[model samples]
Target: MRKIIWLASYPKSGNTWMRVLLTNYLRNSATPVDINKLEGGPIASARLWFDEWVGVEAAELDDNVIERLRPGVYRCMAGETHDTLYMKVHDAWGRTDRGEALFPADVTAGVVYIVRNPLDMAMSCAHHWGVDIDTAAESMCDPTFATSRSLGGLSDQLRQSMLSWSGHVQSWLDESGLPVHVVRYEDLLAAPAATFGGVVRFCGLPFDAARVGKAVAFSDFSELQRQEREKGFRERSLRAPGSFFRRGQAGAWREELPPELVNRLIAAHGEMMKRFGYTTHQGGNDNVD
Candidate 1:
């Protein structure tokens, strides 16, 4: 019985890029993997999957009911698949109101927790959510922050609790009792071959340097951006004002973010930022001062 390999991260923290690398690495094609036909994993919160697993419409159930049933969905997924399940998760690792682990460890293979500097993430998050930087930064600080939380209408996914950016990092790293391989998004950009290779190895996949190198090249930002420019990234937020792959650089906060806003993020997430080497904006390409 194979288990799930969770690609866990706060939003805009290189989850999709990791998926792209995995997709291309596994395919080993001469051409780039189609962005829309991504098959590395299914997002853990797909509503239709919930509907299928429970044999009832997700919309008909209360959110708490849905939350309680989520673990069952994964258990069913684990039972049904003979292969390892790679799942993308934006939700913070947490227990439900009934004291149940939202993601059951019994069914989990392991976790790859991706961390990004909150300072830079704010700008990308703002752009992705179609909000100003301040609003985005504010949301990252709020412990109650979540996505697809509309009760007025149905979203394609169930509401995913993000906690705060700092909380999100802490939950997966310190709280969840899963074996975790931590990757900083900065390292992924600056040293993709090594970083992505680590991810592949952590998931118990055989690593070939040539195959990993090819994947890194195929999943390069320019290639993804080119693909988005041509067709589109289906995973892009509907509210995103521009392409999902727009400006894949790491240190944009230095020029784009105001000094005050930068200070605010550091103040809120300083401890975790320091732990993840996000303490500065004047160091290397990622500005890990």
Candidate 2:
């Protein structure tokens, strides 16, 4: 069986940019993969297809029954796709109780985990949803946040999904035997060719400099934001464009983030944030450039 490559991430953590990069790269190549509609819902489309069956006609069942149905469903779903299936999954690594069984057991590959600085991620999330920065920050820290799987219902679910990009990214880093390429969003934004060239190599596809250029051209935040502003792409489900693409640069958070709050976030996740070369202190935001 050909490998299934899952581009996994916490929401608003640069998954869309990764998809754009991959889709752009594959479109100009002979890669056999379907650019299917990425489904979003209460239970992620991946979780629904891989773990449970839900449709217009829904059936409630016990966990054991859901477990029993997964393999057959996965086999059917995988068989429907062509050679290699590149699916985008937003669920965190620890969200599902089914362990590795939540995905196709025969998955030949793991994922390309895309990470962003939490500070930047918070700002991005705020702008995307038109929420206040503190609301966005709270969403990251609040376990009760329903949308993110990393959020705990009442307590911490793995980590607070809204504020837990470090934990989310680290989970993939710790997984062994899986080819995990950690790509930073800021790096991609800074230099598309080198960053996306790495992704192209990881996907085992022939790299074309032109394709990288095309990806960069399309992935540009300004262009995307303009398109969204003019065409109302944000309202469309299949291609919902928004301020999510706002400020793809690394340290825009410094200018946008209040000093006290920045210190708080730094204190909360400073150690792991430093791991990705982000600064929690008040200084020049030229960490990645």
Candidate 3:
């Protein structure tokens, strides 16, 4: 029953882009896939999905109780579907308080973990969360950082623990007991065909050069941005849940990001960044084309 493929990433990473790419490749339509009408499964943290799958009243349950039941809920979800389920996930990979894995391995086919340079991601994070730049940077440095709390009332999704940027990356890449394909946001820009083609092959999906190329072209940043401009993004866009598409450049952080914040992120995420060949030094950024 191993048919669930998780597309996991920290918030503001290229998770949405990956989803669009995969969907478009599969659809292979004359036009790009609609950003708002994506066909892949909803995010793992979607509260309604849990309530529906678990067949319980979530209003009575606390976050911990709901989280504890998530693994089984996912297993049940996988059992219901005969085809592969490409699900979006933002929660850090780990076990629940009761020691059950948040995402059990038996039902998981694989994971596509997308990562972006934290330096560039900081500004985007700021815009996405409607927070100041400093708060965004600090949150990434925070090991206990979590969001989507339904404290006052219910929101669209459940609270997801991010466990800081570096920890988030480490959780899925190193800790999660599943086969993972790592995709860097910068690589998607620099080598779309090779990068996305690799992802297709890893998922055991049929990879046609023309199809992959068309998907890549269809999901281009400018195209996404233009669509957002003409209409609007239902996902996070400038914290208004509006534009969603911003500067997709790799190393633009050097000119825009504050110097002090750069040092801070480097200090917090230097090791993980180094592991992915990201510069751990101050003032450093991705050397993208």
Candidate 4:
């Protein structure tokens, strides 16, 4: 049976980039896998997958009903696969309204949690969600923040509760059921080889430096941007007019975020920022470039 390994992250936090690298590495293709064709595995929230498993349309079910059934859906998925399946998830680690674990331990192998600086995340999220940086920053702090809860029609995916940025990070890191490997997006950018090699090792996959190098090169930001420009990326939000792979720079927040917004984010997330080596106004080794 294939054990499920979750590629968990906040939105706009390089989750897709990691998936691309893993897909390339796994396929060992002579040519880079098409950006849209890269298969890390199915998203946990895909409505069709849930509907197929439940024998009923997910769109017709109440959110609470769907939440209650999620653990079973994942358990069934885990049994169906013959190899380790790396699935992407944006839901915070928490329980359903009925008090069941959102992701049952019996079905999970481990998790690779990718986190980015909230300051940078705010800017990228603003572009991705077609909102102002200030709005994005506010959403990051909103404990009830979520996506894919459309009332007018069914969303392509299921509802994913973020539970605030800090809460989301803490929930996974603190959960004891699964071994979690944390990857800082900035660290991945600074040292792709070392960082991704660690990820491969964590996933119990043998590391080949040459293979890692090629995967990194193939999935480089420039290449992703090029592909999006040539053929539009499906994952690109309809709300955003530009490509999904907008500026992938690490510290673009410095240029994009207003001073007041930066301060607000710093104040809201100061403790977690300190824990992750992000320099707040009060100051601790400034890791941001």
Candidate 5:
């Protein structure tokens, strides 16, 4: 069977950036595929590789029936052939139904889970969704927050979205026997060559140091932001242009978030937040002096 490599993460946690990197690195992948229009593209497309709820929806006709048909959906997403398929997924496995996690017959060879700071994720999401920081903080722990890719709006959407983040991260982390390689978004940003090298090696693909370097250099926040603004690729989002890459550096929340809100996120997901190496209180510098 051909191998399937899924780039998985919580929403707003840099899955697209990883996709950009993988699309550039993978031998078979050329041109970054638009996630929204993936179904009928050159790459046999499906959202099975995405987050839990999304996989459920993609697998079933009705969103409410996601859990029932999730396994079938993942199988379909993998399609008939097993040629190496590099896919991007935002939903976390631990957060999704167990049936959903059982997809990709070879777990060890197929998963790349990226973890980012919840605080920064919250900030990025708020900017992307046009909401306040507090709402974004709460959404991190709620399973219902509608990511850019999620369909249908429910009454408890906010709560669901928030809970999903924790569930998703924990899901991938809990899988001990699988071939899951956890990548920290912070490390990827700080050291693209080394971090992405791990991804290249994991996929059994040849690592072109120069090309990988070229891709990383080209995929920087400024360049991506420029592309989004002038190229109109990301203009459709509710967020302002350039906001897509707002503060790509970690801990921006420390500088941008209000003191009270920072404390709130810390209290909410503080322990989980530290798993990614994010300090809750910004090293005792609470005052915005």
Candidate 6:
């Protein structure tokens, strides 16, 4: 059986964009693949998959119980799939309360970890989560940060522990035993051909320069925004104020984020930011300096 490859990233970090590109490239159809119909594979935290595999309603179980069952769920999913499955994940690479890895290592083949500047991420995340930028930034630093944690009603997806922006990135980069291909969102924007080509290579797919170019063009930001405008994107959160594909530009935080809020994010995620070449306005030095 082909192993499962993870399309892992923090929320609002270009995971969908990568999915779009891959779908276009793989399909190689005469027309651009429908934004809604793209076969981007299953999300790691879908409650339906968990319920189906575990033979119990995930909504009835406590979060800890669900967390403990996650590795088995993934193993079963991987075991059933005949082809390489590219599953999208937002959960940090960490262990459950019982010391079990959230994502089972034996089932994983590799990972394509997408990373974006937290400054831009803050603005997008705020829009996505229906919160202010300050609130979004604070949540990115909160160690216990998670999505779908509400007990009031069942969510479509399972609980995803983000464990802070810095923590999330470090968790995946540091602990995922499988081979990892890191893709910076900025690089993908700046050099689509080279950057995405590298991703294709990392995935062990046959290289075709022309196909890569077409995929890049097919998944253009404007096209995605246009599709969202015309047909409406299902991935868009109901809480989002505007289109899900709003302002798909790098470094948008410069204008969207205030100086103080920017400083706060820089202070919280300084070392990681510096490592990823995101410099603060305060003379390219972290607050820790």
Best by lDDT: 1
**Candidate 5 versus the native: TM-score?**
0.74
lDDT of 4 by residue, 140-163 (tens): 999999988735435788888887
Full candidate order by TM-score, most accurate first: 4, 1, 6, 3, 5, 2
Per-residue lDDT of model 3, residues 156-181, tens digit only: 67878999999999999999979999
Q: Between candidates 1 and 2, name the one with more favorable lDDT.
A: 1
* Candidate number that wins on lDDT, 4 or 5: 4
Residue-wise C-alpha lDDT for candidate 2, range 1-289, written one tens digit per residue: 4656777776777776677667656665443222232221122233435423334111344344444454455456566666666666554453234454444546536577787777767776676656788877766655335342322222111122222555556555663345688887778877878998998888888878877877677656665566556554432232223444455677677678886666666666666677777764544243443
Cα lDDT, model 3, residue 225: 89
Candidate 2, residue 64: the lDDT equals 41
Between prediction 5 and prediction 6, which has the larger TM-score? 6
Clashes of each: 1, 2, 1, 0, 24, 0
Q: Lowest summed-lDDT stretch of 10 residues in model 6?
A: 280-289
- For model 1, the stretches where C-alpha displacement exceeds 4 angstroms are 280-289
Provide C-alpha RMSD values for all models, in order.
2.2, 6.0, 1.9, 1.6, 5.6, 2.4
**TM-score, per-candidate, Cα-based:** 0.95, 0.73, 0.94, 0.96, 0.74, 0.95
Candidate 2, residue 136: the lDDT equals: 71
Q: Score residue 183 of candidate 2 by CA lDDT.
A: 82
Off by over 4 Å in 4: 280-289
lDDT (Cα) of model 4: 0.86
Question: Model 5 scores what on Cα lDDT?
Answer: 0.58
**lDDT values of the candidates?**
0.87, 0.58, 0.86, 0.86, 0.58, 0.86
